[model samples]
Target: MTLAIETFHYRLAHPGYCAIPGAHPGQMVGSGQLFKRHESLLASPDPRRLDLRASLLDPFNHYRVKVFQQHSKIDVLVIADLSASMSIPGGATKLQIAADFLLSCAQSAFESGDNFGFIGCGHGIEKKWLFPKGLRMGRVQELARDLSRVRSGQGGNGLFQVEPYLPLRRSLVFLLSDFHFDLNRLSRLAGLFGRHAVVPLVLWDPAEYADLPEWGIVKFQDSENRRTRTLLMRPGLKRKIIEAYEQRRDRLRHGLRSKGAEPVFIEGRYEASALTNYFLQRVV
Candidate 1:
């Protein structure tokens, strides 16, 4: 699908999240008018946020930004998991949530004039697909539109092999996903740690980490499969389950730390506001 973009009746300098210390961003551009764009997943057009989400967009919304000014421009690569198991229900799918985080990153990149691009990967690509490279303010929407259609297909292993695209030289890359996959992916992840600045985003739902209400027997289906599994949830069992979840989380964190790369966590409840706030505090 093609993207449609025209300078709105209004214009403003778009700053990303916030300016880095000692890094001076450029000018200010106010909100522009609303317009329609075909989203990646749905059939109809949706209203794109031109400027209504100003607060969420940190320092950028108010100041000017210097594009790609870094002696070595941060190569911003946004990667998301489209694996089927990652399509857990609660709020948005993991892929969509990743897209939102990436969109925010893209916005910041655009304003800063950084070398930005993105790749939405899953099982495999038929025909061919383009991994966007270079900062283009308009391409952020193009990415959201593309991401809306990501399908999580059921398979023996929903996890993907993300090794080939690694060792980005002096670049900052963010890999956002639920990461309920095989540890085999980590060998390559280690290489990434040695070479690039990798920010790992861990997406989770409350149900995965804690117990729901003690509302009696709950019929639940595995997020990876459609089959239903009924299980009784008592207070004791709930505590045990939560403990086990915590243990696993600690293990994951330990593993990443050992290999390198600090993981930033965001739960489904974060929504866009919390998500943006986290980015501002961490990456911006």
Candidate 2:
């Protein structure tokens, strides 16, 4: 069955630094509709954009030409954490949400005339899940299918090795994960992606913390290490568990903000409109 992919809108926070022309505001001066400034013809050397009035008014009598800001394209990438913990199901599996999110990104990027890429990392960068920047919808769909099948029992240590695969030029990067690991690793990863605009998609499930029973015996397994433990769920324990999750949320928020990344927390299921709203508010 074909998955339904919802497309969302986004814009770069700053002018694109890339030279390849496409559809985002850029610092490059070229043949675009937005006029930047008038420059001497000797410098700009574009007779077609010559300003006769400005040339005539020049105190030094130098020919003038108009310079316009050009629109440039940027790479859009999704770097997802495929650790075992991401497979835990609540309303939907985290990996399923991730795949849907990836589809949205791919569709959106394609509509916006930008190249999109995917990188799914676990213990290390998985070659099967690495896709370089491209505009092929077929490849994107294939990658999404592959992502949905992943059930890694490894940690997200491979994130450290992703820098080499990323574009050298600044791009918009979506980092998707449950982030059950150490915050220090997040800080380090943020530093590694310092050149790019990083948006952290924090995936969580209600079953993981919010919807626990107040009186029952619950068995929990560590997704990464395959360790199992049984706990008697009582009112006090439930409160403590929820409080712990809350504390972790605070830390993740602060950590991401400190590293100049604004995180979007997704609980239960993924929605395309929520992300679209984030970009809208950010642009505003």
Candidate 3:
């Protein structure tokens, strides 16, 4: 049953985001180098630009993203998956990292003279979608404020209701999700890519990558569904589980490639620069 998404007016700006600990001067590379790594951005990565982008990270938090705007008339939409699963034990759950990334990107867009907005979705049809376009920094503040308070519940994959909202503009979209959801409805990704430059960020925790568990039998509850299930892990079972996971990953990759949508794997545990580098250096 599809329920109408109650669209409420939520503002942006997070007190915590501002107070988030700052980084030391020499701990990281120059920001211009980060952007320059992506050939599509600037001629070179200037240290000055790197300083601003690098500040998005909390000195204590390792998850950080840098957003740059090279095109106007083009949009930069940040969609974060806020499913219940993202609330698990971790410094910054995939959801939080995504949210922070969006905030950082909004700031970058504002600086680059492009319009930006954000959408947070979970297991339902309705979503807290914000489409703040044009050269408006207020939108960034609105996005930050609204996202800080979002909560997630388990339900259907976010792919269903997302189709109607595609190509909000002939702009670029960054959809970040744990991606442990359904894939049959992946056509929406294809459609979004067809119209706009879209990238599907498959966010996965290290634990999710390899179903690691202590020796004893432990009952595990579904992240999306609270139901608990027992699994006896034999060598054969473990192999099958790992193989199935790999196959699913490959399938999604193939599906997106078929649709012309670039799929990037994002490991939530460590800093993965492959995709970000691709975004920054590959496209011209």
Model 1, CA-based lDDT? 0.54
Off by over 4 Å in 3: 1-73, 123-127, 132-151, 166-168, 209-211, 233-236, 269-275
lDDT (Cα, tens digit) per residue for candidate 1, span 58-167: 44444222122212224567666666666665555665666666666776665555667665556553222335466475666766766755665544231244445533
> Lowest summed-lDDT stretch of 10 residues in model 1?
4-13
| TM-scores of the candidates in the order shown | 0.64, 0.94, 0.63
Model 1 stretches with alpha carbons more than 4 Å out: 1-70, 125-132, 149-151, 154-160, 166-168, 225-227, 269-284
Shift in Å, residue 158, candidate 1: 8.4
lDDT for each of the candidates? 0.54, 0.86, 0.54
RMSD (Cα, Å) for all candidates, in order, is: 15.5, 1.9, 15.8
Off by over 4 Å in 2: none
What are the per-model numbers of colliding residue pairs? Answer: 15, 0, 16
Query: Of the pair 2 and 3, which is ahead by lDDT?
Result: 2
**1-284 in candidate 2: lDDT tens per residue?**
13678888988878998888988999999979999999999999989999999999999999999999999988999999888899875677888889889889999999888989988888898777788687488887877877777765777788777888998888899999999988877756755557888888999999988899999999999887788999999999999999999999999999888877789999977889999999988841
